[model samples]
Target: RITESQNGWCWQGPVEVVWSNPPAQAGSPRVPAVGLHSTTALLQVTVEDFEVVCKGLYRALRIREKYMQQSLQRFPRTPSQYLRAIEGEVWRASDTGPGTFKHLEGFPLCLAEDLGYHVQMKDGVVYIYGDKAAADRNEPKDLPYPSLERFMDDMNFLLALIAQGPVKTYAHRRLKFLSSKFQVHEMLNEMEEIKELKNNPHRDFYNCRKVDTHIHAAACMNQKHLLRFIKKSYCLDADRVVYDAKGKQLTLKQLFQQLNLHPYDLTVDSLDVHAGRQTFQRFDKFNDKYNPVGASELRDLYLKTENAIGGEYFATIIKEVGSDLEDAKYQHAEPRLSIYGRSAEEWPKLASWFSEHRVYSSNMKWMIQVPRIYDVFRSKNFLPHFGKMLENIFVPVFEATVNPRAHKELSVFLRHITGFDSVDDESKHSGHMFSTKSPKPEQWTSEKNPSYTYYVYYMYANILVLNNLRRSGTLLATQTLLGRKRSPVLQYLYFLAQIPIAMSPLSNNSLFLEYAKNPLPDFHQKGLMVSLSTDDPMQFHYTKVQCELMPSCCPSLGLGLRGPRFSGKPADAGPPLGQPLEQRGLCRQKPLAANTACGCRSR
Candidate 1:
């Protein structure tokens, strides 16, 4: 049916899109994207390539800070951690230790300038000047920001010409994209990422709504008006053209930027019960009784307060999701499934709802994604706590769950990022140090004998079920859709964690990264099935595809899809899990699914 097509820049070759998430964003543009509709087409774009680009950009920016800082005394311990003396206030590197190097982060710009020359940016042009300048401008062999300029210039050059593939005129709507290769497309670079197209792709895929799987169902449009919002969100006009309420005027991409400009702020403002005393005005679903809104469920509070009146635009979204709120279904009062109240306390009820609805039990080629450890709604104070808890607590639990070698690497990580000295064998530079390796979960919290937080326990129980499902031959990444038999040792346990620096801000400084550092690509390599996701669309102002972009110019994270396990042997006839890790497909190279369901969402 020609579900989606690539225009702007074209390569006559069959263009493919591997949906990281099917319904990536609600009707975003005049053109259709992932979550605009619940379509069967799915594509998986690895985004590792873009991650490489982000790392490089982050490092380059780091070096620029060092050059501006000009602090030679405080030599950067590593290439990424810069120490510039001449700066007003130098920013710290997003990461540290040897791992940053592996990601292709380069030496600091100041040190790089020390290599040969020092160049400065005056107005818009780059030239050698000041003390570093030579009489002939050629005297200073080294440039101040050579390393930064060289790579970025090359990246910009490549990105410019690449998206505009040998300009073959294509038709869309009525007018042709014949002159589509103009500067606007070049500026937006909005063409389909041709380099990411997968061959022999999975044509039939799922597109569940993003951020809906989390405990914060209200963080979205809320249950009181959910079906109404859903109708507007996925509503199609007479031309089958998708428009969110505001989307009628602005494209989906523009809508996302607008959301980003004013993301939802999750705070004590959310725990506010006294914001208003009017009972009826309060959402009917919000109970002053059981499961009243609190810090854990701040999205609800944010919606009720900051987003109380969404103006004409929001009303339009409600109208669209309900198919105009006056459609036959609305008029008849038809009852659709109530997908709401996904709080921690409501897991049992939520699970039952999914089961009763045959959400996952049907072997329906679905992905059940749980949210990551990020906040439900975007907030200034959200990430620090989440990162602290994850590094300090979950790392140990995850270490125990995986095999020995993987466990050892996690231990190394603990040594480097933490401060506690090892009890048995001392190690250098640990992350959230505890005296002993794999200490009891009790060691993390002040409460005696309590192993982990309530959420961790919840996840552990769920992971046990997921692992069991994998062992019992029910789960096997994307292949499960084909109904193929899977091996016992192999697991389909997947996670969605987003990182930054992979691409630029929509304009200049769109996103702030520093204390919010998380680079978990290494985990993805070990069959963890970890890919990035956009958790809160309204908060993050991103479409799934926009969040997944890899700046065309960054270094490439080795692009290898998860290949097959069992080699030509039968699934049940495979080697046992006890074999050396290398022999098994624990680290296989096959593609994973992006069209599945997961809980918890992040920006």
Candidate 2:
């Protein structure tokens, strides 16, 4: 006889047992058999060492659960239930979806009446006071605010846990075991799974719901699309004023003349917006690709939101991309728009551009990406301190939430925004290490950039309080893609928590890592929750159907049924209301059933 329990990577770990008894007497109560177990059969470590690792892992899960619960974010019920069971507590059914908000189902597009609350930022987190009186009294509303001290304490503990010798050894072995076990299961059950998939009817890859989780708004369309749009704009608006250079107006034709280029002569090669071998490991070059024909004026005119044309070109490009997705009938995309925290007016201007241009799309959900370029802002004297930058980024959202009627356009725009992303090159090293003694954001006036962790922490901290105030589900920065270099302990934690990752091997191939070196296949086989994404179609893809480009990478990477599965469960930046956030363990079956119900017909 054997007992099995769920392991960290969503697979079963078998516990062996040997019975030392004969048959029981007929019609009599059977005596329990003496149970014997092998010491080396289960854990390869000493019992004390195993217990120590187990305790550390349990505490880590608890830490995440606490943070997520307080922030109104989703924490999978399985781990929560397990934690409760370990503590000998009853698991209530109503507790399964703690982050669920009933109001999201039919959330209004129109502005709501203002609540007239006072919103303020202190220590990088927003606080909502009931009134000026409450602000004077230093009392915030009942919403929970995360303590920086406690967060740093938990962070230090987890950091220490990942570096511990025993924990590292245990996690590494466990991950290897999970990978090997998945390989064995695939060898034994791959045919049966395929057979089951094929037996299901009326569904194929074409009809399956696929989502492009990671894409930028400026480059959402392919080079061909951009080229055609440019030509069409020139043909129609050659005389229309489109740009203002230092208070002088320029039309489409004049702007082209100023840049020494013409739309009629522009080919894809001459467009020169695509990433190539030269851009590899050079993020600067990759970034420069945003400028068409090596001209920043073209980027500013077509790709910027606050240009003389009021971002008409950018909006039209996004609308066309959305229309393509709608035509595909089963595809969706979450495209990120940039929000440089140089001025508070940026939010209102972007919102007005969105509303004015009518950038509405059923197939598209929006996300705001804050670029980690504080040093650039500081060097230009655009910002006095990092704290002011944080204020510019988050304070507007807080005001919109607190007084929707006052900031009508921004309030409406915020409704479509599902999440926030901290975007930057990860390879760059910051000299500063974040800690309790580190300078506060207001005091961070130095020209050097802060560490990556510093940006992530403040972003999460602010988002945490914001979510608690709004009561919505947002996929936070925790679900990042590039975790291959992460410690074994962190990787194991990600597995346990079922964190979703959006991998862009094509984008990674051109800019950072080589395609052959991608860990996507290995992550998928090891049961890490991974999905495919075309990070920037304009730079990396040639196809008009940009979402389809990712699936082509699947076969070369040896992904069969896994490819469709990844497409089905896109890590949505913010799922519109009525789509419950995916949960793990017993709760995962609903979406798994839906994804597989379509069948792996292509595979």
Candidate 3:
């Protein structure tokens, strides 16, 4: 016989065989038994095979029992428990493999349903569809687990329960924990749910803090729609009084004051209403001042009014009247002229008016009046109201005509009015006042005289003034003293006239030509030379013709022609050729003989 073990290996009965002669054919031949074996050996072999088969079967049975125990353990102990656990699993596992519910198969359906779980049917298998069970199953789902929409719905429902108060303390704790773990949008969704369940019986049990939570969510999301909704419906004046977990309230109004949401001005209004006593008062005062006055006031008082008392009637009233009541105040006064040599009493009455109007005035007006007033003073020689007017009008005008020609004319006019000598006249005579005898022509060539220094300085000053005039375009339409467009020759003569004859010898013809062609009036010549003689030899070494001629050919000599002269006489009365040796007390007179031709008479 053969037997098979669970392992599938076969075992057969042991048998022995031996060789034998036929008994009928050979009576005389010795015969051996056809078969013989030791019974013990055979029995031992059979027992060994049976033992091996039995051991294999026993091992198989042990394995089967282990699997059975594992399967039974998976069965739900209670219907409710199973329903709740499996329902959730089913939903979660619809798109997943059955292996997903390997651990959840026996959970009671009643428990699963009570816990808000449901079964998802797919491919002839029911799957547990809940977040907790699915997580435990550790299996892939056929569809995404916990859809966003479904999650939101759940949150909304939970929030609604919370808002209805009498919330389970444990559930509320769990929700708070979830809130910390979840996103802001999720929290917002929960808040929306709470708002919806306004009439819930258990509302008192829920710690909604809906307004604060919604505001925080809105701030975090910064979503326009959500913010709009919160601002419109949820936020109250009291809600704006936000306090931190530590009990310190933040200054919400100040924080949001700069954010421009003018179209939603109502939000600001709401905030003001809810603001605490101090903040409410402050906001109210601000509002009252800014509120529009009647349209008639705007039309009647402010339009097209030049230099009006205030910005507008409303603005003026606010400045004058409202300022006294409000915390901030403004007052304006006219400029005073203490620096202009005026008595304080002479200041304008307008100063008081300006203060009354609370109009902001500047010193620019005073500056504009100065030049005109100075002109009047010059013409009149004396004004009884001079000191008073000066005191009243002390404004400084920074903006003068930048045109150089205009500036020069202004300066000249100022000098005329003040009876102050022109700068040119002072510079010319500065050298001659210290000298005694006229300098020799040769001595005049030396670079050591005050006259030469004065000449050079004056010429440089003129050039600078002319260059400035040119740049300012004030020179464009300049005319001669005779009131005709100045000829190039006269212009050149005028430029040369500014330089002492001694100095001209050092200037180049090109420079002369440039000056001649320049459109600027010869202001230096016109203003400086009216009384000063041009042909003074002691001051200027050369004759006028020589001075003019030298620049044409002898530019090098011109470079130092204005060098100092060494004379002892006033420049204007010096001899044409400078001092003679006789004038210096170096030679004695010689008597003329009767026969000698007298040089003086001969001439």
List, residue by residue over 60-152, the lDDT tens digit for candidate 3. 222222221222111111222222232344323212111111111111111100222223322112233445466467542332222223323
Candidate 2 structure quality by residue, lDDT tens digits, 137-166: 999987665566777888888889989888
Q: How many backbone clashes does candidate 2 have?
A: 0
TM-score of 3: 0.12
Ranking by TM-score: 2, 1, 3
Which candidate leads the pack in lDDT? 2
> What would the per-residue lDDT of candidate 1 be over residues 399-459, giving only the tens digit for each residue?
2223334333322221111011001001111244222233332233332211112232223
Stronger candidate by lDDT (2 vs 3): 2
Candidate 1, superposed: residue stretches over 4 Å from native: 1-346, 355-445, 448-466, 474-532, 536-603
What lDDT score goes with residue 459 in model 1? 31
Candidate 2's C-alpha runs over 4 A off are 1-43, 93-96, 99-109, 473-478, 537-603
Whole-model lDDT, model 1: 0.24
Whose TM-score is greatest here? 2
* Candidate that beats the other on lDDT, 1 or 3, i.e. the better one: 1
